[model samples]
Target: MSDTETHARTQAQPRPSDAGATDAGPIQTGTAPEAGRQLPTNDELTVHYPCKYVPVELLAGFGAGCWPCTYEAHSFEEADQLAHPNLCGYGKSLLAYAMQPDVRVLVLTSCCDVMRRVYDVLRDAGAVDFLWLVDLPHLRGPREVARFRGELRRLADAFAAWSGRAFDLDRALASFVPPVPRVDDRVTLLGAHGPLSLVDTCRDELSLPVENGTCTGWRLVQTPPPTLGRAPHEGSCHVCQDGCEAGIPRGDDLDHFLDWYAGALLNQMPCMRMVDSKARAKLVGAPGQHGVIYHTMKFCDYYGFEYLEAAKESKVPMLKIETDGTRQSAGQLRTRLKAFDETLHGMAEAHEVVTRRRGADGGPTYVLGVDSGSTSTDAVIMDGNERIVASVIVATGAKASRGAQNAIGQVLERAGLREGDLTLRVATGYGREAIPDMDSAITEITCHARGAHFLAPDARTVIDIGGQDSKVIHLDEAGGVLNFVMNDKCAAGTGRFLEATARAMELSMEEFCRVGLEWKRDVKISNMCTVFAESEVVSLVADDTPIADIVHGLDMSVASKTAALAKRVKAEPAYLMTGGVAQNVGVVRALEAVLGSSVATHEDSQLCGAIGAALLGLESLN
Candidate 1:
């Protein structure tokens, strides 16, 4: 069998890790580095790079060239303080190890707004000498390349300036290659939009040798566009062309030599905001367009914005995946990839077909999926033919046990079936642990990906906006979760944020959605924090800004924030939008406008997780 056929035939087996194991690790315990690379301890400053006086070995170690400093921690009071409240947990842990008198330069990348502040913390706290701030470009297209390349060059120069050493280009490139293949011979590139742990889990489950270039400080090697920037070739390699063209946007002051000196050489021009008709035209010329495009929820604005147009222009197949930093979508990811590969290889018995139900001998399949969420428990039941039988949503009311029982009872009662009559019961979401009665629990990440795939099997990306949190997942062809990103620390850009804003505005959720749809003029809301956003809205109302416009602005703000988060993890789209936010037409419209693609949301969109969980229960029973 061909490599493609063999992979396609492989069942998308899923192995979920124990709860809490996702966050706890040898890296967290401060043992050996997870990647076999470790920074110096407090008394081991002599072994660090950009050293005041470096021994040669420190300079030669892999991953030793750049030091990453996160902003979650700052030793404002005591350098020796092991822990500090208000500091980010990851940041604090990094700082605790970083301040061990390990004298060295640090490389910082502005992955988020907090990252920008990290530099200030380092500078103000007297923790850094040679600080290289790698400015991040917006998740836009090829315009971002220049900024990224320039930032990388700045970092390189900093390395030379501090240690009088330059990067060996050949050696740097070689470091990216795998040292030796693991025995599994299954190498997986788990593309994600957020942190490394999610990818790590996927690698572990599949026993695949993995390379995490996304998390490491290593930069993407830039490839120049074709001479004269030839028009998009419809027959060219789509991934290579699109990837190459996906550069950072140029700065406003390209002529200003002085502005180029600061890391923000792009002059604050959003990378995706560039006028690149030439690139687009050339991209459209590529032959046999992209095989798949994966987008995260909320963060789909940039990639999602470009995808439909790009797909139209390139005529490529596309997909979407969603996640919340947790690698809970492996099964769905495997499925998506399999389907995509099969379709690409022309081996699929049926060309890509997405339907609510497919099995024969049934009006509908009465399967049940239960999503035990943080704020509520939901249940969705489908017949053998995938027709909806009963769907139930109820307040969890702090008693997940009672809440789940109530939801399941309601759905079962409505379906006129006893609990045992259901063919399957799948459970999902953060509160998976709260329900011991579940036949089996699937992660929300996997469930969301599966649900999105069920709705749009071609979807390579999914964004789920729930009450307390939000996530963007990337999937392969079979709707298996390949990778994911999540919002962990704050409630901004989530359904909870919308709820708070609605309450503060003294508008019902329905009213809030209506107000946004009626907006006549654009008003921008700058803050994403719930409290700050509410304050901004209050001031806008006081200032007599039209309520409709203010509401519109709020929706736009949420879209922008989600888009930003999704970009960090490298989002693409056959975009699927899920969670409660998918039901809010106002926010959905705002997101669709911002992304320039109509998001896929079904009448049962809000019940996707529950549906997925119910499906998983069937798989487990089998």
Candidate 2:
């Protein structure tokens, strides 16, 4: 080994006294331990695979102890011997484990902000030679399989560099199944962890093959594959059914599922609050093909981000479902799992196919995107080849649908096309719901992310200020929304604020931009509320404040408010500015100054939402 490797070994390997010790409190692992139990050797270069609490199937493909799996530590003191009192304990523990010699690689999903920061720490620490972070998008359907395959290929290249072991997909797939000869009669080492546990308490008390590790309360006690296939044991789980259709009793409550995973009672993975980027890279990268990513609460922003990162690293089909931990949702979860299982099974043999509406004589298709805003509605039309055909914008009124229809009609008319000629229509923005005729409605957050991504693939941050609100979104390379922050509580420096101030100053929006650029002195607008700020501006004018200086102060105020949102979302550059406010050169300058980086804005910034909606429609067709 090189000197660098030797140095790492000295700092990373645990002492013999630390045997069977876990970072998450005390673990019982000595005399009563399972037969032949052993920890990965320090010299073996084990990778830490931290899953978001799922079943054993995710760990099936790789050889045992090739990676030492552990649920993340719950607190900082347990994780890092000298962690700060106020620091997020989850990140600390994951990081502490990552520094060990047994952990040469760290794999994790982007489930939350904590994980993202954790990843940053791991990469900056320079302990691991190979670090990869996967940005997992919302896995609602099968198209994600293609995305996963591409990510897996990229990961294989990285693994080859770190481990000097080339990944063979065929061999990997074969290994993904359990060692048992027949899957039909095979038993599974199942565990109920993460969101599943929250949803199903009967994880234990089930007759599964083996139940070990954290988040398993229900145990699979038998695997007599031969005779068991016909008439499996019942009465083990009267609550959640243990995934056996026959075992489900008509009047039984969902609590039987609780008995299915009994091991989780032993320990649980770290909460979203504790995760960070290094932990994510380690946990997400650990899985072989056929990994299951568990995303708990749908509204939980932290875990949501972590799920995204994990999805990015996945090599096989992954199933993501949300649950509120209520028995009422158990049936839905079961159905979702059934669908996921079928999809995973067919992913390999299934030929690539595109679904589209039949065209006249089988001609090409076209997609249209409409972005409805408080101020205006814009439309962008794209052909089947993803090329822009025409764009249109119309002033918005009380009725957003009318404005959208008018914009789309104008775009179609400009292109000399008919409404029936379009194959898909996607609508996006705050007023998206108002346009009920759209084929689909996407969140403005996603639309803006995609639009910015399409415009500049390198852009990782987007700062958008529209007529009524301001937003900051962080995106991965492929234009996936990592997370975002919106000024939904109040309108401070939005276009409306600018317009009101411009009117008070007797200037047009264009003049406001020019006036701010000529300011020689800095002025402060302390109040951010529109009415109060407007009054302050009027007072400043009456007090002989320079028109240039006052405008400069207004621009500064806009930057400060928007910058606060950027900080909240952990903004990184290159940034793209969208929405109506992008037309103001002075505000852009102020934003750049506050952000300490150059900002990119296009002439069609106001049309980004429409363009994004159109793109999504096109993607859906394919």
Go through the candidates in order and give the C-alpha RMSD of each one to the true structure: 15.5, 20.5
Best TM-score among the predictions, by candidate number: 1
Q: Where does model 2 exceed 4 Å of error?
A: 1-355, 358-360
Residue-by-residue lDDT tens digits, candidate 1, 1-622: 2222211111111111110111111222212222433433222223222111111111222123322221222333442253334444334434443454443445545644434455566665656444445666544344565556555455544444444333332232322321222222232231223233434443443322333322221122122123212333333333454355444332222112112222222332122333442332322223322333343323224334555464444444444445432234544454444434433343222122222332334433567778887777899887655666888999888777788888989999988987766665666776665775555555676677667877788888788888878888777888765555677547899888998888878899889888788989999898899999889888888899988898888889888877765664456777788888888888888877777777777877888888766655444433
Error of 2 at 277 (Å): 22
TM-score of each: 0.51, 0.47
Q: Runs in model 1 with CA error above 4 Å? A: 1-94, 98-366, 399-402, 456-461, 473-485, 563-576, 616-622
For each predicted model, how many residue pairs clash, with residues at least 3 apart or on different chains? Answer: 82, 82
What RMSD does model 2 have?
Answer: 20.5
lDDT by residue (22-76, candidate 2, tens digit) is: 2222222222212343433323433444443222211121211233333344334
TM-score of model 1 vs. true structure = 0.51
